[model samples]
Target chain A: SQQGEEDPQALSIQEGENATMNCSYKTSINNLQWYRQNSGRGLVHLILIRSNEREKHSGRLRVTLDTSKKSSSLLITASRAADTASYFCTPGGSGAGSYQLTFGKGTKLSVIP
Target chain B: DVKVTQSSRYLVKRTGEKVFLECVQDMDHENMFWYRQDPGLGLRLIYFSYDVKMKEKGDIPEGYSVSREKKERFSLILESASTNQTSMYLCASRLAAYNEQFFGPGTRLTVL
Candidate 1:
């Protein structure tokens, strides 16, 4: 079963524009993480926002968590052509001393130059 | 740099054949995971191991088995391959304390 569901299945924008993707999960999570994947490549971890944290930023990536609503969002500021890829949100929870994460169907962002 | 390597970037196999996918990590991370990615469905975890010889099934573990005989290596085995089993296989590892996971280049498997 998929724990997270990302909205805006696909998005297209011009270079330098901002792109935002949202995710909603069903269960309580210890942290929410964002990842990027280029075509034919493995996923790269972008940032992690813990349950206690409301927001986090790294480079041009900003992540906000609303635990009360069981939702999270990733915002990319000034996106570029290089930013065209699939963005995934993973909600992680720990059980019996091990952490388990489930990834949602990603939001495919296309940045046209 | 943390490096995770898979045995092959692409593989073609016949139906009913036993297939093995290998993964190795150089970072000495304690937790390793195997996931399969497909169109629309995204990535689904097949199995994970926290330590040598200790394995646990993930959400979609049917038709898949895993082996973790060594600390640095993890192997996912397909008991008998089928056309439906063809997908991109990804391997990832993370430290016990960290939430970030490092992933290997995926293997695109085609079962004919």
Candidate 2:
């Protein structure tokens, strides 16, 4: 079974519009991270929110994590055509040296210009 | 900048033939992972190595095996190439916790 599952499998919005994608996981994770993939390439890390942090911000990207609900959300404010990509959420363990990051199916966002 | 390099960006192989996908990271990171990306399934981990000669099976490791002969390099091997095995193979290296992962461009494999 997949540890994380993203909601709203596909989303579309015009350029400059805000986009939000949600991910739900079932586990006691030390932290959750967001990543973006353009086309068929490998994913690029976006933001990471630890279990102790509720919300985090980086540039136009904002991420919120609710440990009680085991859910996380990534918000891309004022999206651009280049923001059109597949977004994924991943959970990592607290172990001193945990290597694997369990990934979700991902949400595909289309920013129409 | 840390660079994770994949030997091939695109590859084509015949069914029943053996295939190998190579990934190398220059950061000297101890953790290396291999994943396969599909349209709806996103990225599924195939294998991971935390240290040289160490391997761990991921969720969908059925037809795939991995080898980690050195700290900075990891290899994913397909014992018998099958059409179903065709996918976008990704390699990533991370330090610890939920830290940012440096990813390679990825190898798009097609088994016909």
Taken over the whole model, the C-alpha lDDT of each candidate is 0.90, 0.87
RMSD of 2: 1.8
TM-scores computed on chain B for all candidates: 0.97, 0.96
Docking quality of model 2: it rates as: medium
> Tens digits of per-residue lDDT for model 2 on A2-47?
3578889999999999999999988778888889988655588998
Query: TM-score of A-chain in each prediction?
Result: 0.92, 0.91
Candidate 2 residue A74 C-alpha distance from true site, Å: 0.8
Residue pairs in candidate 2 whose N, alpha carbon or C atoms collide under 3 angstroms? none
lDDT of each residue in A55-88, candidate 1, tens digit only: 9999999999999999999999999999999998
Model 1 TM-score, 2 decimals: 0.95
Best candidate per TM-score, number?
A: 1
Instruction: Count backbone clashes in candidate 1.
Output: 0
- The CA lDDT at B68 in model 1 is 95
| Candidate 1 per-residue lDDT over residues B1-112, each given as its tens digit | 8999999999999999999999999989999999999997889999998889999899899999999999999999999999999999999998873368999999999999
| DockQ of each candidate, alpha-carbon based | 0.68, 0.70
Per-residue lDDT of model 2, residues B1-112, tens digit only: 8899999999999999999999999988888899998887778888888789989898799999999998988999999999999999999998743577889999999999
